[model samples]
Target: MLFVTHVVPVNEPGQPRLDREAVWEGLVMKANNALPFVPAMSECEVVERHGDSSFDRAIRIQGDPYRERITLEAPHRVVFTRLSGPILGTIANEIEGDGDDMQLRFSFALVIAGTPGNSQGEEDYAKNMTGMYIAALEGTLDAMRRIAVDNAA
Candidate 1:
């Protein structure tokens, strides 16, 4: 899998704080719909909320259902596993710790199989994919942080 994680540190040292669950609640459950950080190309809905904050939703990007019933977990760390085509497996989004600050991260892990008939260097593919995924993820988290900061006051 082409595993990649992007982290964006929240600026405030220790302001109004929320637990990991609350953070998950806002970022996953509500932020994608009600909150401003939501991308115009997509929409998100939660079908479940458990101890670890697992939820099911169909991501409609550009009015097309690209993903259905995507399962994202918040156990120990936020992990989103996409169950769809072209994507073998991924831990889409997460938030890690930095004392009082939160480091938002996401991944683009791809499952590739080596073909006997035709061969392609997996390392080169992995490197290209990693760069693209990390850039996009970092931009996403930066946008989210801006939105959160704008509303925090």
Candidate 2:
């Protein structure tokens, strides 16, 4: 098992304001057709709901479905998931951020289970996951933020 968490604030502050709906629009609706820095999941689509936001779509990555429940507000939050498939389960993303200052923070976790016939030390298993899944996720978030900042500007 490997656990990695990061908090990166947008360098600028007091972004003035952009409602959650607007930010969600940029992320799901507008971002769908746009190139995403997170390559693990692909082809995001958003249904414009006038009220609380939610959506489901196919993630080309590993051929899974990522359903999301959004708390659309200042720091729009999304609890994205992919259930079923060889991956078993994944927290596609649980993210929140302000459209102003282009600020955002993403937290994620990845666990690789040992096979029935395999025996690996806890430290060793964690190390392997950190090298692969954790590293990939970190890189993806970094790229996503950079692109969001550039685009927001």
Candidate 3:
């Protein structure tokens, strides 16, 4: 299995400061439709709505289709579990700290289906995936900031 976690400070100098509500709203938006936040995703659709806090989405990333069940823990976290995809595991986006000192954390524990655990190939793949996730986190923060600015307007 491949496990990695990355955390980024949500408040940065000169950028629109995003409060917890704004950040949470951005997360919810991304959970429902990731195309605006995830550059690699070509399509996203909510396939099933479990409730106000959970749903299943079908997404195409780089032209490959995948399904994920998303659970939202309101102003705090969003968890995405792979339902049908090459990789199987959970990805979590979390908000840590409070007020002006908040941070965003992204973590995942995933393994390719049919692949041996801890193999060198899997290690290399994990590294690549980590980079992509890092970029995604940055993009997410950027989008959140944009949302905050738009809402303040």
Candidate 4:
């Protein structure tokens, strides 16, 4: 098992601030509305949605398609578990407020043992890929912040 965590602060003065619940709502809404925060994600659509807490989506990133099941705990966190794909693991995002703004803390754990061949090399690759994924997510956070600010105007 390999885990990576990254924290991005969603704070900028003059930008409209969303309460915790609103932030969660926005996050779920974004998942349905074209996933603009993730430039690498070419397509995203909800295959199963039952309010904010449970949903399954098929996402295509760089031409590879995969499905993820997300379970949300309002105002604070969402857990994403891969149902089928090249990767196997769970990714979680924990959100909270910082004064008028909020912070998004992402934690990812990849179950490297499930990989085919399951060699040391695969473990190393999973670790490297985890780092890259976290970096991309940080970029997504930046894009989200920009969108939030723009929406406020």
Error of 3 at 4 (Å): 0.5
Residue by residue across 1-153, what tens digits does model 4's lDDT show? 666787766655654555565566656665554366666678888899877479898998668788898887766787888898876789877887655557878788766445544678777876777666666566655556566678778
TM-score of each: 0.55, 0.46, 0.96, 0.75
Stretches > 4 Å off in candidate 3: none
**lDDT agreement with native, every candidate:** 0.52, 0.43, 0.90, 0.70
- Cα TM-score of candidate 4: 0.75
Candidate closest to the true structure, highest TM-score: 3
Name every residue pair that clashes in candidate 3. Answer: none
RMSD of 1: 5.4
**Which rank order by lDDT, best down to worst?**
3, 4, 1, 2
Q: Indicate the TM-score of model 2.
A: 0.46
Q: Pick the candidate with the highest lDDT.
A: 3
Tell me how far the alpha carbon of residue 33 in candidate 3 is from the true structure, in angstroms, after superposition: 0.5
Best to worst by TM-score, what's the order?
A: 3, 4, 1, 2
Candidate 1, residues 1-153: lDDT per residue as tens digits?
A: 465666656444554444455556555543235223434335566554444445555555436443433344543344555555344565556668744676666666566545122235556766766665565455454455555566677
Give the per-residue lDDT of model 2 (tens digit) for 1-153: 334554434333533244444444444542333225444555555544335444444344435454433333323555444343333333433235544444444444433444321345645654554444444445544554455567679
